[model samples]
Target: MDKKAKALELYLEGFKVVEIAKELGVSQPAVTKMLKQFPEYHQEKERRKKENQEKARQWRNEYKKQKREQYDEDYELVLKSHREDAAALSRRGKLSDDILIKLCILNYDYNKEKERLVFNESAGKRPADLPRSVYVHKNVLKQFRIPTRQ
Candidate 1:
């Protein structure tokens, strides 16, 4: 359960001491103690870990120094490309009447779908002999979360 034991296990498994020290977030001197307790070749792995950490820190600093205008230009390019795509879809007659009908019901983003209203068949006050067809719209039925056996 201790970090020293884990470092020892990792060393025996041929992981570089630099990797062990980096993973355990400990100094080489401390790692040497864990290595001595386990008595394996963990020394080199620790040195490599410090180098890896320095490289990682360098990348993080560079990322933080990135400019806001770089992101703004990316947004402008994406907006221009999307406008062209919409115009193309419109020109090709891809946005037809039937497609528009389905799109308005399903693709109107937020206000698109119907709400569920319960009307159970078995416990109904309706007539005894009824048709077996699905009466509600498929989208409306989905709102009820009903389990259909058929």
Candidate 2:
């Protein structure tokens, strides 16, 4: 094939100009000059780039959709298991109203601690807009090396 045809073919196959030059036994500048003589090759390259970008966008959207669905399913399963465990404890006379209240308080404290840990680890700073009562749990604050305000 001629230089132009060979260059176009190599470009369509994802070869860089340098690689095409090596394959065609021409200098890089000469290969560039020849390719520039054909505007259609540049157009084809742009079209391929746009098509690849669209394909990547679609793949990312599909992946995020799949992940969101999976997260929803897993969250539902966890909620159901927690409800079942609570019910089982109630049936065995192990769960009382006061105990349930305490459990809720503990759950709130655990979640706050987890949020603080994640925020501190990521940002290396204290969280903003938090009320004093939120950080009243001394143990959690101590773990993060945050001094408690009196």
Candidate 3:
């Protein structure tokens, strides 16, 4: 590389401009002019940045593809196992239909509680004065439901 380019790279690599000028044994203004006059360094920097971005994009795509493949394989295995377990439980008569229904109800309740926790956390400090009936949906609509007395 040219002395000017080498000096410029050194300066860009964190050496002070004055130090680079002193090392190159050129006047400070001369070094500055040399750096400014060369467009190759700027082009190289832009090219490196673009290359890094492309590499990052490729890495992300590969990661997403691998994750999706693993997810599908795990999903298939889980669904297969779940169906097999449900069938075995059914044939064994281990769970009364009533107990199974209660288990399902418990699961639904757990999920609702978890979702409510996330919703509340995202909403920050909820105003105590806000009505209990209000809800925000994925479609960006506000829903207000009135409670019916049993």
Best by lDDT: 2
Candidate 3 lDDT over 1-150, as tens digits, reads 888778768866766568988898888888777777668556655677798899999999999999999999999999999997787578766754433433333222112322221213343543343322222333332122233489
Clashing pairs in 3: none
TM of each candidate vs. truth? 0.26, 0.48, 0.40
Roughly what TM-score does model 2 have, to 2 decimal places?
0.48
CA deviation > 4 Å runs, candidate 1? 39-150
- List, residue by residue over 34-110, the lDDT tens digit for candidate 2: 88878877887788889899999999999999999999999999999999887868776766444443333432332
Kindly report which residue pairs in candidate 2 clash with one another. Answer: none
Deviation in Å, model 3, residue 38 alpha carbon = 1.2
Task: Indicate whether candidate 2 or candidate 3 has the larger lDDT.
Answer: 2
Give the Å error, residue 139, model 2. 41
**Candidate 1 structure quality by residue, lDDT tens digits, 41-148:** 435556667889999999987886675667888999999999976975686656543334333333222222333233344544433222222234556535444455
- What is the RMSD, in Å, between candidate 2 and the native fold over all Cα? 13.9
Once model 1 is optimally superposed onto the true structure by TM-score, how far is the C-alpha of residue 94 displaced, in angstroms? 93
Cα TM-score of candidate 1: 0.26
Q: What's the CA RMSD for each of the models?
A: 16.2, 13.9, 16.9
Decreasing TM-score order of the candidates: 2, 3, 1
